[model samples]
Target: MPRFMGFVRMEEGQGNPPQALFDAMDEYIGKEAAAGHFLDGGGLYGTEDAVNFVVKKGEVTRVDGPYAESKEVVGGWAIMQYDSLEEAIAGQQDFAELHRKYWPEVSMVATLRQIPDEPPTPAED
Candidate 1:
């Protein structure tokens, strides 16, 4: 099976949804995970808590955010495995629809990208 990442983006200023919406999302996520479509996922704190770094010629620089000007930022992500790209896309589409239905007041988007499959290497004994 090929793996895919479902990247979740949210518009700035859109805080967390209600408890009911979180409950519903939790239910949906549990079902999908039990069925093996959802391998891993998580939501992130706002950009104010984020940090940016740059490294050049062995020198490192760090920048802390109040990264306020960006209109959208990644808020969450999901990893899934499926037989084909279409299947991966459809699975992500379902998740996106869940947000649309449960968090109608918030703006969220999910994009799917295929992860290259790699065979596991044997352990040295």
Candidate 2:
């Protein structure tokens, strides 16, 4: 089985989705979790208290959020496992569809990508 991550991106400060959406999501997650496909997932708070560390010219600088540069941020994510990429895609599509159906006015994107089984080699200097 291959593990994949679904990054849920949406506009900042849009407020929460509808209760119906949450209810639907709860049901969906429950079903998938029971099937052993959904490994873990959760929503994230706004970037109001976020912190970032940037390195430039071998110097480290700390920057605190809420960041002004981002119009959209990843508000949620999921770690899931599937037998094939196609199966993962379909599962992710179904997850996205729930948001589309329950929150028609809001725009959301579920970016799905597989998690590598082993660490990659570090870049050479």
TM-score of each: 0.83, 0.95
lDDT of 2 at 12: 89
Q: Which one wins on lDDT?
A: 2
lDDT of 1 by residue, 2-95 (tens): 8888888888778777787788779988988887888998888888878989799999999787677888999888888887888887778878
Candidate 1 ranges with C-alpha deviation above 4 Å: 55-60, 118-125
Query: Per-residue CA lDDT of candidate 2, range 4-69, in tens?
Result: 999899998888999999999999999999999999999999999988899999999999999999
Best by TM-score: 2
Question: TM-score of model 2 relative to the true fold?
Answer: 0.95
- Lowest summed lDDT across 10 adjacent residues in model 1 is found at 113-122
Q: What would the C-alpha RMSD of candidate 1 be, to one decimal place?
A: 5.2
The TM-score that candidate 1 achieves is 0.83
What do the candidate models score in CA lDDT, each in turn? 0.84, 0.94
Question: For candidate 1, what is the lDDT?
Answer: 0.84
